[model samples]
Target: GKEQKQLASELARKGVTKEQAMRVKQLYEQQNNVNASNATGTDVNESRLREEMKENTSDMLEDHPSTQDLARSNQVFGRNIFNTRNLTFEPSVNIATPLYYRLGPGDEVIIDIWAASQNTIRQQISPDGTINIQKIGPVNLNGLTISEANDYLKKTLNKIYNGLNNTNDPTSAIRLTLGSIRPIQINVMGEVVQPGTYSLSSFSTVFHALYRAGGVSDIGSLRNVQLVRNGKNIATIDVYQFIMKGNIQDDIRLQEGDVVIVPAYDILVKVDGKVKRPMRFEMKKDESLSTLISYAGGFDADAYTRSLRVVRQNGQEYEVNTVKDLDYSVYKMRNGDVVTAEAILNRFINKLEIRGAVYRPGIYQLNGKLNTVRELVNEAQGLTGDAFLNRAVLYRQREDLTTEVIPVDIKAIMDGTSQNIILVKNDILYIPSIHDLEDRGDVVIHGEVAKPDSYPYADNMTLEDLIIQAGGLREAAS
Candidate 1:
């Protein structure tokens, strides 16, 4: 009852209709009653009731004004990379420390001094970015590269030990190296799946921080990811460049207290039909239709490259415009634009087909040399001996897309008595065989015959011939 009241209150807050609210109340009551009655019933009954209730609730929620908008903004391209658990962007601790890596707090520094007497010292950088050496005193190494820190350390330790900086003095040598790396805190906010602060390794890049924050949200823009430092946007990282071309030039290493912001998309266009990859893609303002097509993996083999159809939303309504191939580079795409690459028409040009009573009947080219009906017949190795020469039908498609049967006098054309009929595109010529023109019945010799089977009838055949062909009559003949 308490849950029902809360649901009703939420529905009222959302301005849902009174009838809809009452329906939800009825469904809740039905669920409670079902659960109470099914206490002693099988698990299947309870599971079925739960499923039905869930489906009803989902249906009602789908009809809600707020959920309808969410349903429309479902999937976007390049957004599912982080949704999988199999892939991770965690920085490996086993990698060698980069030379350009700067020293910071929480990082361990190792100093090895060897001479007639060797000694090793290991110290972690304090919160104030200083590591204390036993005899050499405290040395600050903040915001300095590894090389710079090594030089500073060598100069500071030289005062305590003699000949520490002399390269020729192998007996008195010093080495400095990093031990354990530090961890940096990064804030990933704005249109991300999980917008919060993430504690990550200092060696982590922009991708690592995004992975820790559960990647960009559905409405987030992957094309313009900003890397903000000290309240200033330092770098703009385009994830599409990395996802498409595997170029991670802009994936800079993170610093302490860095911010990775994934703002909402600026322009989103969908490319559908006859493309290698058909889906919605986020584009930048300066990008053109050609760039969008490249993101969709170019056009499929059967795509009509001559032109494309684009539907753009103008005010409250949508207007369609046909984009030619020449204008693909210049055409600017707008938000909510849908571009379609339709397949070429399923019709062939400069082709003709011939079948029925032909020696080698098949498709033939309708070129200048083979334009007439006589030439097409000759290209098909001429017609068979049983071909009916009186009339042949040519199925031709007209401009209206309707089939028109044109009768060709094959006998007149072959005899050169009539003018040769010129063939057009997609014309199917059919010359009927003589047998197809007439029905030849079969003769059945049953009962008294030795072979009681049907035989094809022939002209000028007598009863004696029929009996002989049937292996003579049986001895018990009627």
Candidate 2:
């Protein structure tokens, strides 16, 4: 009752009048008090029952309604909220056989000289791109191949070991071998997922760097991915080509301080009219008409493949005569282009009329070339039981613009006695009813008549006589 009174007060504050609020409070107080006491007028038992219900509800809530169990039962993985199109291009990576490893800053090398004194030393290149050796001073090793660095180090060390003129000797007094390569830090910016600076191995390619950066995002374009080094675009990678057919020519090895900039997807083309997957497709660079068609899951079976046309953004129309010789090179596509694959047109004769006692008589379409009367009758599920087979008439229009009525023997044709007649376009076949009773002379009394019905024929059946036979017209009838 106190809770009900508080709720009524809230309702009064929310636009209910004071009198109405009091009435609602009193009504709830009556209902709540009605079940508060037993027939003996004692409320102790009711209070005990309420406490037991609360305990039971609390126990039920704690037993099997665990949040972790509920979440585990409903958890799902790999469920994408947005539709993703799988579009892959040929891979075109230009790579050669392993030849030489270049020595740069952070590259380690071990130098061993086997002479009067055994001198073995391990040195890493300094920040200035040089390595300091005993008696050889600082030697620039940046951008020098392993073979070149080894030769330079040998030539310098030979000056201290033997004589500089002894460089022509094939046998060197010192032996050097390349050690570990340093990790490079590159930046992946723009529309890629988790774009940031990533530390990778010096031998890592562009694909490895991209994988570390979480690859491109949903809106990222795969066509014009730019690789920037020293504020210049070193290469534009088309991952579509690599994805379609292992042609990773542009998957260049990443250098230190390299930046991969992925731009937003910009190209979009719409496909409609007799396509299996008719939807707007996001296009990659150098995408042509053929590529777009394939992106739309190819043309449908009824598609007029030869009659493909495209409407460009500027309203310019382009058509391809044949899909056989369709060279995507010649028929390039652009953004906002609308491509349509027309359907094969219906050209065969299709209209015919069948009236009277035939079992499903109506105007039917004879789409086939050799549409005969037997086929048309079969299509209508044959004639009715009361059909006059002997008096069947076939009315055809001649080329000279005259109607020709030909009597057909349907019974003989059905029994294989006579050849069934071939039907033409726009032919009308009528089968009369077998019950050829005399035409009853009657007058139809309808609309504005008191008794709207048919009256039998008389010697002189006038409109007045018909009206009299149908009973007098009411006042509302005219």
Candidate 3:
């Protein structure tokens, strides 16, 4: 207590009031003796607490992110819906919306003076943004807007006129009108029918740009339009909504240096397996399974239309049985869908050989379909000029190697009585042909393929997968 008095006195000597010094000393003593902080029986050891915190943080990093935590993130803030309406600096086109601006250096301006030519004049704001009038001498307009500049000029001109013509009162006020850029210029590019910079009489919106760009290429999609400003992506406009839904708000006005990019339409579904034509067909909005089947020249007789599988980009699939459809001709298709049709040849469930002459041919998807008997014949080059129609049969077997051969009469099936055996998963077909003894072995494919192929098969393996495995198929060759 005596020490406290001395400390208080010392504090007082440092210009602290006697009351303040005493209060601080008393408070310090009480806190030290009584332990003002939260007193805890379970004292946390710093090192142990730190280690536990580290482990907890590591565990949090490992566990899949919880939806609750994800929702609070900024990304989710705009996920459901958010806007930058509060933003002040939204660059806009020259004139779709009348924008007001004060004058700046390099900003052109036109002024109208009713006075005679000998009295009034046309003048440009100087580099310093100031203009000098004949009678008004040097009127400082630097950093002032056109309206402000006019006010300054009018006041000065009125003063001079009132001095020159004492009878004419210097009471006329000034007015300023900011004019629009008569010919606004903008650039359009990428997947457009007519891509170029267009000069607009007034600042126009994205629609005018597309019109100036020759209204987009046939393959261009207006739905996902990109509006770039100052070499940066400013907006992702839904032009489709702007046109079809009549949502004018979606059509934002464009500014100079704003590049409008209309992305190319994604209109393709990969038709593989058992089709007469295996290619990417440009899709239509009203397209269905029949459209794709017809695009692939309809189904082959042996096509396992029942096991029609649609593989999407992420490996997720929607498999349908065209055979189960009863009609077997209509299934709606989506972009990037991989339609897998069943093969006609008999498969050995898990064991099969692709003994055929095809480019990079081999045994593929166990039950992956190879089209009509004719397609198989073509894969093996139609029995190598030595095959007999009577000897032709699609051989099948159980996993135990129990074998059964079904003679396939190509002509009879073509005439339409054949069930045209549908293909199944893991079913391998054997297209056998007499091989020249000097051939030593069957055709082989390797090095960069998902499944290195040795036998010549037509289906199962895809060109993309093959290229991915072959170190991306020497680009120079492509």
Candidate 4:
């Protein structure tokens, strides 16, 4: 119960819900019970179990809703690549041996010789880098490629076997192939999820070692993963190259006792709003804003490309700046910078809307040919016959952004009597129908009528006509 409470407290500190904490505690107890039951005579590897427990806890924490919320709230990108359960990134053992694979201790080699007599020999390289032949004594195969080892073995065995060097003879042949591969111990240090020494395959690369170490940590730099060999930094692996362009040219093969170090991130910038893929990205020292945007998959379709806004932290206070399109390539990005690309305004530039009595009443373009009201009407197939040509209302926006109603004399404008008003952007012209101007009321006939209802009133109608329209008077009528 105490341990469960402690676990609950830790999860609570991480913003986990009470129900989630209980689920996590239940899983934890189940794991502990399993571990306890298997503790007897199982020869369990404590380090591997610890790593498994850590991975399980990480998986549970990653599944919490708060984790996703944190990720969307400007959390560092590429951190969750290692937190996934699907991609193990384990090295394949069934792949063909690489030509550049150097022979090392504990590696098994198979030698097949056929010339007048057939003989096959299997030898494992010793710790002293030498393999004992049947009659040729020990030959050092370590630090040599497969082709190099084959050439050396042929020269050493030519004294006992004839025609060994003859390439023209079809029956005479010597072949060298790798058998069971060896294991190499590597140390994965610095900002990685799990920093420890792992026994990996001799053919393993830097990526394989990283995967075995549970990948880089949340604060680690993927762009500068360094490979140290024999106290020297031999190579630097940039994961971004593989992620962005699928280029694995820098994923060099790992040697025994090699050290893979993931350093803390150098510079990070967040890009959100109107971007194809918005997230926080790690930046190199010399990378620009354009490179960062490209890493974010560029701007979205509705993005305002003319300029971008940047909120930068300048030591004591935050400073905001506008970056124009021309400066994107040259603008050097700094750490803790937030870049935003806003969407374009919803309003249109050369648009005018016509409602009510036009033939084709809708929106029209305010171009040179349709600049005047009369031209707009002509473009709309002229006003309808019932259109009130005496006065129409044109709604225009003033410079102060207030709506202004202008009374238009349509008859005079159509007849070329008055000056035609030029239309501007967002001008709404409304022509009313003549029926909308007349008051068409109805007459109500009640009490004494067979049907107590209202009917449309006509001019100079008598009460008898009104009663006839209401189905005449009833028997109880006065």
Per-candidate TM-scores read 0.74, 0.46, 0.30, 0.74
lDDT by residue for model 2 over 385-436, one digit each (tens)?
Answer: 8888776889998888699999988888766788988888879998888665
Candidate 4, residues 404-477: lDDT per residue as tens digits?
Answer: 99999998999999999999999999999998898879999889888889898788999999999989989998
Where does model 1 exceed 4 Å of error? 1-74, 112-119, 160-164, 167-175, 409-419, 442-478
lDDT of 4: 0.86
Candidate 4: residue 115 Cα off by (Å): 5.9
Runs in model 4 with CA error above 4 Å?
1-70, 115-117, 167-171, 381-386, 411-419, 434-478
Candidate 1 positional error at 293, Å: 1.3
Model 3 global lDDT (CA atoms, 0 to 1): 0.54
lDDT of candidate 3 at residue 383, scale 0 to 100: 44
The 10-residue segment with the lowest total lDDT in model 2: 75-84
Cα RMSD for candidate 1?
12.7
Q: Clashes in model 4: which pairs?
A: none
lDDT of each: 0.85, 0.70, 0.54, 0.86
